[model samples]
Target: MTDIHPTAIVETGAAIGENVRVGPYSTVGPNVRLADNVVLESHVVVAGHTEVGAGTHIFPFASIGHKPQDLKYAGEETRLLIGKNNQIREHVTMNPGTSGGGGLTRVGDNGLFMMGSHVGHDCKVGNFAILANNATLAGHVELADHVILGGLSAVRQWTRIGTGAIVGGMTGVEFDVIPFGSVIGDRARLAGLNLIGLKRKEFPREQIHALRAAYRDLFDTEDGTLRARAEAVAETAADQPLVKMVTDFILEKDDRRFCTPRSGE
Candidate 1:
């Protein structure tokens, strides 16, 4: 029961499931597999060794599964794996991985890629994440579950954005962003805990309070020794979920760099 526009080109080797729709002038290349209920709007292009899960909708002019733009790609076999129920808006471009970086770019279920967004090679995007309009993630970036990248925000290569973190509009993130924290500005200062986001996600009030206190102790001091403060806070606030999130984020090392509080602490 799939519908394919006359002008659209689907390679014979492609595997398209039931109820899928391919709009005008779209193209599905060989080795591409789209599960049931997926929709590819006008001018969409899905190529390479890519697989789109069920119920994913890719809007007009979105180019997915394209070879990595990295110079080191050298025509190696790479893959782009997108999970179910994702909404990839117009003009968004997602590149597959490079052999130099594990040969895979993966996106989890229920993610939203707003218009003009670009996800570079080797990135791993988590479930329910939101990439606002024009947001750009460079190569090797990892975005955890429920993280929000505001409009026009740009994250540098190899940076890890923790779960539930929020990067405000126009921010430039060069380092790892702590879980549940709000970051803003060019160098990305730690504004505070993402209380509004946590509240919206229905996190309890007591957990929010503990996180706020932990944030204060971790970032408010002149010494700004986040590790020690985080350890102490973790020992005292162990029972709080929010506290555990903060402590784990501080302790986890991404690409050998810990999340550092903004300078001038």
Candidate 2:
């Protein structure tokens, strides 16, 4: 029940599901698995222990599930897991995890990875994330759902971007970004809330209003500590899921510094 081109090479032990379409000159390695309705355009290379979930479409020349590009990597078996309904565009490169940083690079559902984007080793990309053209995430970065990385943006290793945050084009993120935060500039700094994104997602007006108020109290006001402010806001906005997400992100224990607003803002 699959449509595979004669030029395509489906290696032995590869598991391809019903309604899958393999195009010209593509290669599916022995350890690869493609679920139902998956489409691999011409010249795609899916190697290693990679699994393409159902309803995903991969464009031409993507090299996925390849060996990690770490000098310390020593042939340890690792895996790349892509979720359903993802649109992986041309020339994107996603590497598996390295032994030093766990053994799996996982991407969640409904992601849009544009041309030339790269997900480095051991990254965990959440659902509904968007990586614009040439966006790059260094090893061990974590992107929460609804996060958007603008074209040419690069995130440093060990950084985490919380849900609904957006990093502007050409920015370099060296620290963790808060939920719903919008940032721009070469060395990215917090730039208020992602108002447009919140609106587009149709978040309830009351929730949005509460989030805005919380943002001000957490960042604008001189608080005892970020965690303390987050907890206070969480207590007040107990019914708001978005508020909890923001507080939870703030409370996450990580070595990386938190991204803050520029001076004189």
Candidate 3:
């Protein structure tokens, strides 16, 4: 018993589950699958080989499952898979994967994509993440669980945002963001531990304290050798969750160096 607006155009080959609502002037293309309780607001377009999970709501003028805007993209069979209970706000554009990038763009459950946000080709967004208004993630980016991108922030291609990290507004991030840390500004320097976010997530006090200590040790250094700092923190603070997060961040760094502390601190 789906409720489809008369102005909406749903192709016969599209698979729509029960209790779905298609608003006026929306379009659903062939090979698109809308699961139970999904709602597409007016002027929304669900195209290509896209699959919308149950209980997901897409707001007005949002575009999902469009082909990659990459120049390297050929006419390959890419797919976009969105999980359940996601709220995609107005004017958001989520693009599918490119043939060069394995052809899959995936988003996990309970995520919030705010108005005017853009997710580029082959991006993998984890559960419970929040992309604030005008937040943009480039191709091949990965957002771990509970990451928060503030308004007007843009992440460069292939960058990874670690779990529980908070990216400040108007920042341009070109490197990986450490887990449980806060980043701000164009060069995206590490501000401090995301204490407020940790508290909201119900992280233990001991863990938070240990993370604060680790942050001090890492950033308070003269030369800021993250490897040396991480090793030192691991030896003493290994039992703490925050210490483990810092250790993992140091180990996972590929080519770029971690954000260093400001001088005279």
Better of 1 and 2 by lDDT: 2
- Candidate 3 lDDT, 36-112, residue by residue in tens: 99999999999999999999999999999988889998789999999999999999999999887779999999999
Model 1 poorest ten-residue lDDT run: 253-262
Pairs with steric clashes in candidate 1: none
lDDT of 3: 0.89
What tens digits encode model 1's per-residue C-alpha lDDT throughout 193-254? Answer: 78888999998788788888877777778564567777888898889887888788777752
Candidate 2, residue 33: how far the Cα is off, in Å: 0.4
lDDT of candidate 2 at residue 259, scale 0 to 100: 85
After superposition on all CA atoms, what RMSD does each candidate show versus the true structure? 1.7, 1.4, 1.5
Better of 2 and 3 by lDDT: 2
- lDDT value for candidate 1? 0.90
Per-candidate total of colliding backbone pairs: 0, 0, 0
lDDT of 1 at 39: 99
lDDT of 2 by residue, 1-265 (tens): 7999999999999999999999999999999999999999999999999999999999999999989888999999999999999999999999999888888999999999999999999999999999999999999999999999999999999899998999999999999999899999999999999999999999999889988888888889765977788788888888888888888888777344788888768
Q: How far is candidate 2 from the true structure (C-alpha RMSD, Å)?
A: 1.4
Clashing pairs in 3: none
Please identify which of the two predictions, 1 or 2, would achieve the higher TM-score against the true structure.
Answer: 2
Clash-forming residue pairs, model 2: none
